[model samples]
Target chain A: MLSEKHLPAFYALGALLLIILPWILTAADSSYLISTATRLVIFAIGAVSLDLLIGYTGLVSFGHAAFFGVGAYVVGILAFHNFEETTFLGFDGTLTGLIVLPLAILISALFALIIGALALRTKGVYFIMITLSFGQMLFFLFVSLEAYGGDDGMMMFEGRNILPAIDLNDRITFYYFCLAIFTAFFLFCHRLVRSKFGRVLAAIRQNEDRMTSIGIRPYSAKLLIFVIAGAGAGLAGALMANHTEFVSPGLTHWTKSGDLMIVVILGGIGTLIGPVMGAFVFLLLEEFLPIIFHELGMDLLKEHWRVVFGPILILIVLFAKTGLYGLIFKKEG
Target chain B: MTQLFFEQLLNGLQLGMFLFLVSAGLTLVFGFMNIINLAHGSLFMIGAYAVAVLTNLTGSFFLGLLLSFPVVAAFALVIELLIIRPLYHRDHLDQVLATFGLILFFNEGVSIVFGRTPLFLNVPEALSGAVQITDTFSYPLYRIAIITVGLMVAAILWFIIVKTRTGMRIRAGTTNPEMIRALGVNIQALNTTIFVVGALFAGLAGGLSGPLTSVEVGMGENLLILSFVCIVIGGIGSIRGALLGALTVGLVDTLGRAFLPDLLGQFLDPATANGIGAALSSMSVYLLMIIVLIFKPTGLFPVARAA
Candidate 1:
């Protein structure tokens, strides 16, 4: 009854459950669960976007978090300007989601274009290191911007951006809003990956030489996918900043990229729904690991769970070739 | 202005030496083993921590430095055998992720063991005083010593890599591992040796840097990125490239940080000048790297592969 062939039905059932999760939690008298679910959906957006480049295009970008950070900063900077009643670079910083969300996506895409253009010149480990350096450069740039609260980061005094007919202030409304965007984006990505462009990306990943011989320029193709991924990450960042009402330089840190990479890997790279599963598992572990350690009376272990997490990661790389998604799907097919 | 220029130049050279110590090992590993060890920074951290704790116990900085090499080497040996060896054949992403996992592990593990408080290591009394470089400019003796030690190690490494029998095998291994294996060299043992040696160099950089900077958890990470920049700019897998790249990075960073704000103050408002200068100077090395990549995608000194 639960074979690999029925995976899509299972995914549909899971989506239905995710859709009604907040209601179920509210009925169970758990308001906090809704917030966690919101975070899961937001991070899943990022992880899934990253999977586009890493899983499909074979571009291991260690700076994907930079786009995410830039997106959040666009929201944060605008809000900061609005709160201070100051014009930012000759424009009134608006808090309309309609304006800000698109702005976030465009700015992030532009950054990805520049960085990806340069970083794509190098291959393999060099690409990883260069992307990391670019990310760090952005991180430091934010840290030095004293106007935007500098190293301490900025807070959103104004609530969520206004949307006509949508009261985002309500926890359930915000959660569902995020879910709606995430679902749409996920569908877009699923369809995109199955398209001709996705086929070109996969071909480049498998054999760039062959693709080049076949008249496909890998650079433009990879760059296109990279921008798409950045835009997706930017959307996630905008939503995240609204949900938390805060933005920090930590969002762009290399470790944040690593976390996203972990989600992709844990979910099973190249799988459409795998990143969502990965984000859920990662967030759940982050939430419950401390409690699990506390129950065992290992408070120090609870605090330093990464000590255990590191070896588990190594073991996963060495042993689990397909990851958790593969385990659930029973086969990669 | 001339005195200040010379002083900043010396500072740059000093920073370059510390970078060279780290980059050399990283380049060597990449060249021969083709493994990108992200936990190389953790090895640097271990070196500093070992020296800090040992120096505190023994009351001798020299003894602590001497002890750190073996300790770090042993740790690296274990890691190489158990962890890094398996990763050699895997794709770069898996290696990056696994090693990244190691970084998280080591950072937290050190934090757990050493506590969250930063550890301090003082320059030895013999090296603490300033040395007169000129009539108007005096340089710290400890920094000069770091430069000297780095050069000596560089020379020694050159000798080993160029002239020694082991060096020939390493060179061969880098160009063609299968051929070297067919020639009766123990490629496994050679890899193990190279890893240990690289770890020792990283450890040395950390141990030496302890007195100059705060010896704390995660300190090696920033330095690790800088060293990667060095290798990338100089050309991956080439010792000459690492040295050149390290010096270039060191000079640019030191001189930029010291002078950029003042330089910008003349053109812009002081507040904006300082803020923008700080950001730009921090970004200067990476900008250099990007420019180099654009002009020479392989790097400034790419190692030649055997046909």
Candidate 2:
């Protein structure tokens, strides 16, 4: 039986795996593997941040990737300005990770604050649709910015941002950077979900009326969590932009947000570590499903793999309500 | 200037009617079942595809249109039975997830079958020409026909909902499902009927609009979001709300796109004006929704039960 006592050990093992992933890949002479692992870590950051809202707070925001896109655009826009040697608004665009990442988080948090304040006014499916509208709004806004390449997206041709005391240009160093940030974020979320605020949010999710009866206003709690989640998503976006060296309006599309939601559900809703596992599994399936089909001599199936993926997702939703993580760590009486 | 404004108004009306056709079904399904059918758009796509394929095969647009309603409804009935029925008892998130999965299935399935190239459906021969509306203005007859058909459907729907026995049962079911179930109404059959009816409406909208737009995979996705905005603004589950919401969205979207850039160009550079205008026009409906939500969280015409 899985017990609360086992959590720390589980986390420790996870940390160990993350720390050694790059080394293992390097030793295996698999640069591609290292890059794929980096992508997983970055997406895990996004999935975990999204879980903070959808899983913990019960806010099924269909626009979480808006913040993710905001983060990436911040990095991309700043880099674009730096490349042109121009000042945007007032500040000279800097390629420093320290400056850009914090800016990304703050900007995304502010966007979340504005969006969440209005979205939180409604409950249930209304909230979902409102968030999706906001996401689509941001997507169109980005696409309209012709200076940033519009639909074509922007590329950081100069490569990764500079961090003091470390070379981000090195693939291995970049991998560690992402891992470290992801670790910090995971720990923060772990503590947040256990904190007083998180409990209040969880209570609100269960029954907002009861919380209100207890003299607890659920609105602020929900808003705070939404902003925090957005900030985390923003940080992930910044890392993603750095990793891919590209940012596009597609990053904020409603479909990307749906993908994030799928990751949260596929792992385990409201479980802090579940999103990380979910991201890993989701990306692995995306990577391997086509290869597996090809190996089976079904090349046509490989091209239309989503036909298979969709049914699997439906089955998971129907049969594994608690998700893959819950199945693995079954609760005991 | 007046002629141009009127022309845009007519375009808005045509678009609004199309939106109503889609939103009406969505509102009905959501009202009673309390399920968010993301794959509702898939039904719309199916309708358009059905019309396109059938029309091309038969070389008769009218016959294709006649055949698509039943074909799409049958498809929806199967989907409701095999997929959507189990989800009726699930939470909103699960419904959203499952329906979202269905969307992927339908989109990819269509792509695999149709090979991704958009299918074209021509305007019917009789409805192809433009009619003079004013000394300076001529509008396409097909668009006017759409508006007339939309109003007719709306009237029929209003009559069915307000003046029929089944409508009473549906309204009762929405307000109190358990009470209606205890009253010996087969809630399952009612729900399935409503789902199929919603699918029929979506497919009809798709078939009718196919000639106006390209019939292609994923074409319904964007329209689905817009229809959602209409439902949210008009108040979910309220037919009156859906009609009002659809018109408001259609007008705002059409007029905003037609004139906003020109308005902005008077003050700003053309490039900046164009950029900002496009962004604002695209966001206008959502902006209206946000404003409406802030003032009326339940929407402009929320059903009594929803409140």
lDDT tens digits, residues B97-204, model 2? 888899889998999999888987789998999999777789999999999999999999999999999999988887878889999999999999999999888898
> Candidate 1 on A201-264: residue-level lDDT in tens?
9999899999999898999999899999999999999999999999999899888999999989
Per-residue lDDT tens digits of candidate 1, residues B217-271? 9999988989999999998889999999999999999999999999999999999
Measured with DockQ on alpha carbons, how good is candidate 2? 0.79
TM-score of each: 0.98, 0.98
Q: Stretches of candidate 2 above 4 Å error? A: A1-4, A27-29
TM-scores for chain A, candidates in order?
0.97, 0.97
